[model samples]
Target: MLVETVTLQIPEILYQRLVNTARATQRPLEEVILHALQTGSPPEWDDVPEEFQADLAALDKLDENTLWQIANSGKTSAEMERYNTLLEGNSSGTLTEAERLELMALRHEADLFMLKKTQAAVLLRWRGHRVPTP
Candidate 1:
């Protein structure tokens, strides 16, 4: 990995917190600061499943407005109605093959939607926005 060095200042309290953490963890201050920098920025998603990694990686480059939009967006009413109907059919074990395939596709889309929203919120919070709890 390429490394770059930049000089910067931090609040005294924040510096103190980093120093304290380093001491507690028996690590050098630089190591602690590097870890903090990496963690405080958008995630690398190393431990996440491969399926979710690409979506999350893309979010890291998005601007704040785009991230906020993603964080707040949800399903259309029509999509929600269809998804719910499919779920009901699934629960009752009455789905035809076509409906079953539709449900599977819808479920995957729903999963991706939720993952994007969550990642957007996390990035917004990390960027120091006041993300309200829902």
Candidate 2:
């Protein structure tokens, strides 16, 4: 296949580093640049610098909550609106210190209530009784 050549004027520091990398890896500078461009993100394949490998490896171990929305993915539009409202109310600075403390207490109590309900539902299911919640 015929390949087209395109010229890019990169900063001298970056160009020097790319050339040094090519020499170290025993790959053509043009090939290294092309591979890096194709990857769009560095550390995709053979052209990544050794200095970045450790940081890249660390990124590979991100948890689902950090990388993907798992629990909140199933929320409907109405549920999302309600959640957002609660968050807004809780975060608003207009609340006095006493009101803020009360809000925090209410949030904590709601969380514990939900936890108990979930446990009860699970137990009911195990005992062959239908438990319903939305």
Candidate 3:
């Protein structure tokens, strides 16, 4: 690609956002702004599964605090205990119909929770937050 220099003035809010991203990523402000311009979103949602695209896409509108809270959340201890028991029963082929249904519901809910958490982390990182791995 050929290099071209262009000068432009951006609003204060946009400039602050770019500066924040640059700081969080430990990169230059110009590089962060350039990446944002080229990729649209720092984190791409287009490649996510069709069923999850809408859910993930909506995270873009969330505030940083809310996204951070979500990124740090997890299933409750009680829920995890129950889910584990159900999973063990499933592996043993000893689950009753009601138990099986409950297990499936729990499994689906867990999947959704994990996906949401991952999306939230991605958004936080894109918005210049240091999202640590779980």
Model 2, residue 70: distance off in Å is: 26
* lDDT of predicted model 1: 0.77
Candidate 1 TM-score, C-alpha based: 0.69
Clashes of each: 0, 0, 0
* TM-scores for the candidates: 0.69, 0.33, 0.68
The weakest ten consecutive residues by lDDT in model 1 span 39-48
Inter-residue clash pairs, candidate 2: none
lDDT score of model 2? Answer: 0.48
The TM-score, computed over Cα atoms with residue i paired to residue i, of candidate 2 is 0.33
Tens-digit lDDT string for candidate 2 (40-110): 32223223445443433332233323222221224368755755565676677566666667666656545
Candidate 3 ranges beyond 4 A from true positions: 1-35, 38-40
The stretch of ten residues in a row with the least summed lDDT in candidate 3 is 16-25
The per-residue C-alpha lDDT of model 1 at residue 122 equals: 81
What does candidate 3's lDDT look like per residue over 8-52, in tens digits?
Answer: 887765576566556655678888788788756356566766877
